[model samples]
Target chain A: MRQRLMEATVDCLVELGWSGTTTTLVSRRAGVSRGAQLHHFPSKQALVVAAVEHLSDRRRDEMRRSAAHLPEEGRTRGVLEILAAQFVSPVFFAALELWVAARTDAELREAVAPLERRIGRETHAYAVELLGIDESQGDNRQLVQATLDLVRGLGLAASLSDDARRRSAVLDSWAAVLDHELEMP
Target chain B: MRQRLMEATVDCLVELGWSGTTTTLVSRRAGVSRGAQLHHFPSKQALVVAAVEHLSDRRRDEMRRSAAHLPEEGRTRGVLEILAAQFVSPVFFAALELWVAARTDAELREAVAPLERRIGRETHAYAVELLGIDESQGDNRQLVQATLDLVRGLGLAASLSDDARRRSAVLDSWAAVLDHELEMP
Candidate 1:
């Protein structure tokens, strides 16, 4: 029941954002009674935060599963393409919505703060593993981190406008540069 | 009067976010009565939208001035630092608060949509100029754009956690690779 409600919460958040993800709507989407919803999450903040954390975990797993089968040819490009898509996808946008909301909502921010830290740390480890990089090497680690940052920034742009051409251009150039560097060293 | 109100509006946004940025608070901060605030901006939507656009223009001008004097040595790093700073500053945070608020508020989104489009276009052009890159070259343009994307992503991370060390590491790695690439051709 909690899992179902959490999934519904994410769906509501991605489609409706913060304001629209009301308990009523989430209950309806999750097919739970209002009473049941309250029992699981007393406030909207708790519900939304749980949903974001849930989405991140699910996404991390999905990436790991997808990454294992990447094609040998153009592997760098392949990794970048997958990572970029994830960065701009609806779930990431949903998380972005929360991040933005938490900026001004102190209570919500408190709820989200620790979860975000844990998620970020886990994400870095997951990314390092996914990229098959030597995490001990500062340059290698930074390159992967930079790739994530670049993709995230491009994803934010894509959210606002028709920035596909520009986004791809960035990915291509960065991938080329990263490929060259990793190959050299 | 309008300028004062807009400044207060941005202050409220950075500190209080959307839900907390009441017109009354903005008017009080601006040292104007409610009537004057409404006289300048008929509604909260009008007020917040105007403030964000105003901030964008002001920040744009600031970037232009700062960009003109970038040091010759490690020019790319310097440009990226300035830009990354801008992306995480109060004005950017204010704009981010608006972006998140607009996700759930259709009326607010309508007001912000065109302005966001204009701001983004101007930002791209300004970034090109700041980096002293030829606009005609696709590779050069993409590299500049990529830099913006990376910084924006890092800025987003900075907003959430103690990301300074990671952000600089990414910047250093990307700068090295970019320097090598640009120098080669």
Candidate 2:
């Protein structure tokens, strides 16, 4: 029941954005009574906080799973492609909406901030593992972080455009960045 | 008179997003009569469109002027930093409100799309010139476009956060990508 409510919250968020997501709407969408929602989440903030945590946790788990399957001799571009695809997907957009919403609402921020820190640290650590690059010690860490940010920015921009060529352009740029990074002495 | 109104429109947008950028608000903020504003703009959409163009032009001019001051031996990074600083300022936030508002408003989209294309083209061209890279052929043009999109996304993400570290992280990531691109054989 809790899981079902959480799913409903994400659905409502994607369709309605932060302003439109409401307890009544979530209750109806989940097919759960208002009482059940209130039981689990005393307020709308509580519900949203729970939903963000659930979403962030799920995202982290998916990334970990993908990393686990990487080749022993991992290829940077291949790993990036997998991460990029996921980051550009609907699931991540749901998380993005929540993150954006958190900016104005303290409850949501409190719920999401720890997860955000975790994500940054985890991403940094993952780069160390996958690229065999130390994030704390050189200009390489800056490059890795930049590539991740470029991928992130590209993913969001691609989501907004109707142009396939533009989307392709973003990917090509990511590849170029990766190629450039690897060539560094 | 028209120039003052345009400036006021930008000021209102920076302070209040599209939903808050009504003609009445602009008039009040500009210290002009509603009749005067209406005579100039006729409608809120027209006013907003004009405001977007005004802001974009100013930003482009600022970019050009800033870039002009760079030493003849200025690296691409210096040019990009100036460009980045210009676009991430409060004036650019007004431009972004136009973008975010356009997502749900067709009229706004119609008003802003052409301007968006021009900006994209201009930025890409500028990047090529600043980075001393040839983009007339091959995938480099596309990479340039994607890099600009990354800047846009990072700028918006920075606006939504109070974290200077995150902002710097985003910029560092961008610098890293540029570093990679420059090193490409």
Candidate 3:
């Protein structure tokens, strides 16, 4: 029941946005009773924040599982593709809605700030591990960080419109750049 | 009166999220009568959309003027810094609010889509002009686009926290990478 409600909250966020999403709507979509929903989440902010955190954890675990199956050749390009896809997913959109809404809502900001920080640290660490990057070397850490930023921006652009072709081109170009930078002695 | 109202609309957007911003609030902020505010923009969507387009024009012109004053040496780094600053500005935050709002609001999506496309085109053109890149060369165009995406992502990161030091480090690293890439034959 908790998982169902949280999934519905993310769905509301992605389809209805932060403003349009309501607890009643989420309860109906989740097929959970209003009393049950209120029992679990007292407020909309609490519900949505918990939903995003829940989804993010699931997505991270999924990504780690998928990483184990990556093909041997062209691994860098494959990893870039995976990262780019994650940004364009519904969970990312749900999180974006919260991020923008949190900018003005003090309560939401307080709830979201720490979650965002933890997600950032964990994602960066995961990327470093996936690429086998030696951050002690010159600029390696920054380059990996830049790649994440680039994909995020591309994801934002994708949210506005279907720019998959252009996104693919940019990702391919970035993968080449990353491969070369990492190869440096 | 129009300029004042539009500026006030953006102020409301940054200070208030899309759901919180209203035409009444804008009129109060602009010190304009309800009659005058409605005379210019009939609805909140029209008012906010026009406000973003209006401010974007002003910002672009300001950027063009500033470009002329960039120091001769280290021009690439200077240009990167300028680009990064634009993403962190209040105007960008205003635009971001609309972008997220538009994702779920069909009417707003219609209004914001064209303006966003125009801004994307103009910003890309300006970046190319400032960087003096030869697009005929391999991957130069994609590299420029990636740089814009990188800064945008960094801007999003800044929106959450005061990551200025980390942002500066990323920009410096990108400038060096961009310089090396462009130097290739």
Candidate 4:
């Protein structure tokens, strides 16, 4: 029931955005009673925040599963593709709605900031692991960070429109650049 | 009065997000009468849509003015910094609020979609001009697009927290990467 409600909350966020998403809508979508929903999440903030955290965990798991199957040849491009896809997913959009809402809502900000930091740290670590880059070397850490930022920005553009063709080109170019930069001794 | 109202609308969007920003608040912030506010914008949608277009024009002009003073040496880094700064500005935040809002609001999406496409095109052109990149060359266009995406992503990270130090490092690394990539062939 908790999982269903959280998934529903994410769906509501993606479909209706932060402003239009409400507990009633979420409850109806989850097919959970209002009483049960309130018992689990007393406020909209609580519900949405929990939903994002849950979704992030799920997304990370998905990434890990996908990572295990990356092609031995052209693995860097494969990893870039995976990272780019993550940014365009419904989960990214749902979290984005909350991030924008949390900007002005202080209480929401308080709840979201730590979770975001944790997510960032984990994502960065994961990217580093996937790329097989030694961050202790010069600029590897910054390069990895830049790659994440690049994909994220591409994801944002995707959010606005279907820029997939251009996004693919950008990723290809970036993957080549990363290959060159990281391969340097 | 129209300019003041538009500016106030942007302020309200940045400080309050989309849902919290009201015509009444904009009028109060602009110190304009309710009658005058409605005379210019009959509805909240009209008001914000106009505000974003107004601010985007204003931001473009500001970018043009800033571009005039770029240093001859290390101009690529200078241009990257300027672009990065634009993404973190209140205008970006204001536009972002609308983008997130428009994702679910079909009416606002109809209004915002074209405006965003135009802005994206103009920004891309400006970056190409600033970097003096000949897009006729292989991968140049995609690289420029990636640069914009990278800064925008960095800007998004900045919105969540003061990631300036890490952002600077990422920008530095990207500048070096761009320098190398564009210098090729």
Candidate 1 per-residue lDDT over residues B30-94, each given as its tens digit: 99999877877898888888898888888878877888788989887887777787888888888
| Per-residue C-alpha lDDT of model 4 across residues A1-185, encoded as one tens digit per residue | 99999999999999989988999999999999999999989999999999999999999998999999999789999999888888999999999998888899888899999998998899889998898878888889999899899988888888878778899989999989888899544
CAPRI category for model 2: acceptable
Best by lDDT: 4
Native RMSD of candidate 1 (Å):
2.2
Which stretch of 10 consecutive residues in model 1 chain A shows the poorest summed lDDT? A176-185
Of 2 and 4, the candidate ahead on lDDT is: 4
DockQ of candidate 1 relative to the true structure: 0.68
Per-candidate DockQ values are 0.68, 0.42, 0.82, 0.87
Which scores greater on lDDT, model 1 or model 4?
4
Ranking by lDDT: 4, 3, 1, 2
Winner on DockQ between 2 and 3 is 3
Could you tell me the lDDT of residue A15 within candidate 4?
91
Interface RMSD of predicted model 2: 3.4
| Model 2 TM-score relative to the real fold | 0.81
Second chain TM-score, each model: 0.90, 0.85, 0.96, 0.96
Q: What digit string (tens of lDDT, one per residue) describes model 2 on residues B50-143?
A: 8777777777777778777676543555766776675577767777666545644566677778877777677677778776677764566766
Compared with the true structure, what per-residue lDDT tens digits does model 1 show for residues A1-185?
98899889888887787766799999999999999899889988888888888878888788878888899777888788878888787778888888877876777778888987887678777766666777776488787778778888887776665478767777888778877776332
C-alpha TM-score for every candidate: 0.92, 0.81, 0.97, 0.97
DockQ of 4: 0.87
Ranking by DockQ: 4, 3, 1, 2
Clashes (N, CA, C under 3 Å) per candidate: 0, 1, 0, 0
* Candidate 1 CAPRI assessment class: medium
